[model samples]
Target: MPTYAYRCRECTETFELNRPMSESSAPADCPEGHQDTVKLLTTVALTGSAIGPAASAPSGGCCGGGCCS
Candidate 1:
């Protein structure tokens, strides 16, 4: 399940809902029983670096293989 963020225009309350992707566009009510809510655009923060031997491998070419020299 994915979490969707929403904001209620009536109460100006921000809330989150866990729902399916299909229902992400559906209308949501705030915790305070406000129906005037809009889904907020959220962003996922991804932080990581590639690992393993392939990550450290250098680019190979004719010069890298001593063919140009």
Candidate 2:
């Protein structure tokens, strides 16, 4: 349960809360019941595939010495 993003400075609503990160800094009441809230700074984007030996290409220019063929 983790989804917290709030912004409601008395009517400029924008909310979301599924809290449990220890309340995630509790204090949220938007959805038109503004409580002068402010707590939004989220960004998470991760895609698969990445683990051990598979990164070698940087010895020259244009294509690591292959001249961009």
Candidate 3:
């Protein structure tokens, strides 16, 4: 299972959910019962004694997953 973050456009509330990868793109109902919600793009901070080249590299974009100018 993977965790997903969702933000409600109506109430502006944010939340998280644990679901299967196949349902990642599935729509989520906001806790406030708002239907206008979107899955937020999340990021990870890979900081530990054992770091990798990707984590050490400078952030390329907003999410640091590249795909940005």
The numbered model that scores best in lDDT is: 3
Which pairs clash inside model 3?
Answer: none
Model 1: how far residue 53 lies from native, Å = 3.5
lDDT of each: 0.88, 0.84, 0.89
lDDT-better candidate, 1 vs 2: 1
By TM-score, is 1 or 3 better? 1
Across residues 1-69, which tens digit of lDDT does each residue of candidate 3 receive? 889999999999999999999999999999989899999999976776755654555667777876787
True lDDT of residue 41, candidate 2: 99
Model 1 poorest ten-residue lDDT run: 53-62
- Sorted by TM-score, highest first, which candidate order results? 1, 3, 2
Cand. 3 TM to true fold: 0.64
**Distance (Å) between predicted and true CA of 56, model 3?**
18
Candidate 1 residues lying further than 4 Å off, grouped into runs, are 48-51, 54-59, 62-69
Q: What is the per-residue lDDT of model 2 for residues 4-38, given as tens digits with 9 covering 90 to 100?
A: 88888877778788979998997888888768889
Ranking by lDDT: 3, 1, 2
lDDT for model 2 comes to 0.84
TM-scores for the candidates: 0.72, 0.30, 0.64
Give the Å error, residue 17, model 1: 0.3
RMSD of 1: 3.2
Better of 1 and 3 by lDDT: 3
